[model samples]
Target chain A: MNEKVAKLYQERLNRYMTALDCGKPDKVPVSFGIGDWIVKHTENNFQEIFYDWEKSIKAVDDILPEFDVDVFGGGPTLWWPPMWDAIGSKLYKFPGMGLDENSTFQFVEEEYMKAEDYDAFIANPTEWIATTYLPRISTEFENPSSLRGISALIRSSVAFAEYNNYMGASWGKWTVEHGVVGQFTGMTKAPFDTLGDALRSMKGILLDLRRRPEKVAAACEVIVPHNINYALSGAGADTRFPCFAPLHRGSYPFLNPYQWENYYWPSFKAVIEGLWAKGKRTYFYAEGDWTPYLEKIAELPDKSIVFDIDLTDAKKAKEILGGRFCLIGGMPTTLLTYGTPEKVKEQVKRSIDELAGDGGFILGAGGVVMGDAKKENIMAMLEAAREYGTY
Target chain B: MSEKEKKFVPEPGTCTPWKVKMEELGGIPGNEEIVKKDWERLDETAYNFLWFWVHR
Candidate 1:
């Protein structure tokens, strides 16, 4: 890094680190991502941005100079479509392939892992995932012994490695050029989410809770270690930043208090505790209302998580988790989509007043800002964060 | 594979443990540390690849 870039990087990193530790800094650190929303502003459509790494990075490069934030969340797209294509994976329907080019990708949730496979999965999770889950999910890998299946495996593995390398290089370039600090190092999921979201589908898991509750709990128990390992491995064991865990199913009304306490929170909390033991913190990206579970979530190790507030009551979160843990997210994502720029600024001021008063709070959109989110509203939020976000 | 070997479950974050591989190789005449290090790295990659499918 150049001298100028290094200085900027340190300034941003220190600000971010301070806020993460629940300490007051010179200013409230701002986190922003070039979500799919950026595609609408760019000359290129969703496909090019999702498929081409250069185009994805370029999309961010164009915006980074203007987006003066402490942390750079990420680029326009999450995955390279070609990698999904290579595996013949039925996980998602990418733009231009299954959906219109202008539209964002959609996850194709299914009971990829059947009910009968529970015993096999619980018996040996990794082996079952390799031998059974891969073949079931990837059409090309249906017959792993076959030449086509083996080839698909090779191609997908190569693509996975390449994608990781490209992302690292892209982040490096962004840091050198714009002096951006990334929000999180690695990614993981709650163990129940690992089962429900991908393996069982929401419907399937709900049924299992009624009929095969023990199996569900057992499977999740088996997953706790793997989740910790995956987070560490994916992050290259970096403890400097939290591992991103986009929590689902654990949110309110998804599971009742009884079911959540029995099946969900145990394994999920175990994963968090496990990561914390390894000197890692979890970016608890609570997507929906977690108002009901705030007290239960507080049971986690102090500073072991940076709790995100979306539909969760902000005051309750601050009253409960504030000072002990860093609180992020204040501007509701829907406001960015429909509200005017002035309204966004109003929300920003209110958020800073309510949440950032003490410290341990970062200003950002509450959740993933969709493609329809207005640029004016986003720019307003970024501008207003600086305008009001001071110690 | 033998009956006992068939029942062996690999540890988490590993597809095949180096001990298992070492058993298969009987013993390494050369630098065992070098071979084990490279083997574990590849093993880790394989483990990540397996978990990658479900993680999505």
Candidate 2:
């Protein structure tokens, strides 16, 4: 960690903390994240690098030095090799879906749950964990070859974190000694969402809601707390802030708004409240038109962070949630990909000027940076934040 | 149909018996109607999620 880089990082973190309170910072902080598949694709290979801990760290290090985002975070989904090992699923590369690391048990296998199985799923979840889940990782230990692969994955995550901190020293000034890296864990979804994943096949989950509402609710109740526990445990109970992304791909255009609220909101509320009570704040990434759920979300007990919303207007979001909570993202990934740098900058400035009025605002691409998003546009977003995010 | 009743279509591709039941006593759309409504209410949650990403 370079002394100068450390100072820059510390100053940036301070500014960010202040700005989150709706106060001006010395300058705005910027962060960027790229998925592993994207990195593998860009590098044109996946073999050992994906499993190489040092290379993983370098991959992030290479990006942060130039991009200079305040926080250095990674997805727990990517980190938990043990969990993947337990599942015994192979990571299949899908052209557009990113990486498809299929789960070991066919969670949605036909006739596995003939009402009686549902009874068993609800009565003792550990049974499900033991039968359907734990085998994925436990098997790796038994198989030496598989164990080696698992070991590499674990080592790589450790290395990734180590390098993240080493590199973070450059960003953190002396007072803030290391990179502020946060990882997502225990991401509980709406009861319906959990039910959708657990009891029903993707299609079954969707259809079950219309056909077997009670069963879905029962399954959700049984599973949602488990997810909440996992998320909190992964994030750490005292975590001041944790990030969560619930990819509502099918739920969005497919489900009607009314059905969404009744089935999903309670589980979401329960999870948010559970985390909040434990003194952890959440940074929820609203993947789709959460526009339908904004009013209910406003009722949260504490308004600590922002929502990284996609396909929604930040200005409108600010109007609805500005006084209560901070606002983070809104720039469209597609716009960033296709638009000119100036156009990107203009959007950033508008977002900042309009939403950053009383403070409590940050800027980012509306969604994750896929492989296709132009690197230049990402830089443009950073520049615009720096230029306009000043006090 | 009444506004609340209108909200009670069977879940997307299935019959009415398959939907998740809303525990919230009826205001409109029974429990099903409120799922979307409750999601919309999360503007603050959304705001905070983005705010942290940008600022942190």
Query: Per-candidate DockQ versus the true complex?
Result: 0.86, 0.02
> Any runs in candidate 1 off by more than 4 Å, and if so which?
B1-6
Docking category for candidate 2? incorrect
Candidate 1 lDDT, tens digit per residue, A1-391? 8898889899889999998999998899999898999997788998888998888888899989888888989998888988889989999999999999888999999999999999999999999999999998898889999999999999999998999999999988999999989999989999999999989999999999999999999999999999999999999989999999998999989998999999999999999999999999999999999999999999998999999899999999999999999999999999999999999999999999999987899998887889999999999999999999878
* C-alpha RMSD values across all candidates: 1.2, 14.3
Label model 1 with its docking quality class.
high
Off by over 4 Å in 2: A1-6, A19-24, A36-44, A47-49, A73-87, A90-116, A133-186, A249-251, B1-56
Candidate 2 TM-score to native: 0.69
TM-score of candidate 2 chain B vs. the reference: 0.27
* All candidates: TM-score: 0.98, 0.69
Tell me the tens digit of each residue's lDDT in model 2 across A1-391: 5686567656766755665555666665554565543453335333233444445555655565465566444410144232233323232222222343322111213322344456666765544433443233233433335666457445433443454354344333322434543323235455555455433445776676787777766776665555555556434344655546454522356577766666666666777777667766566777766665667777776464457667665666777777677667757778776888999999888777776777666666666655456767777887777787776
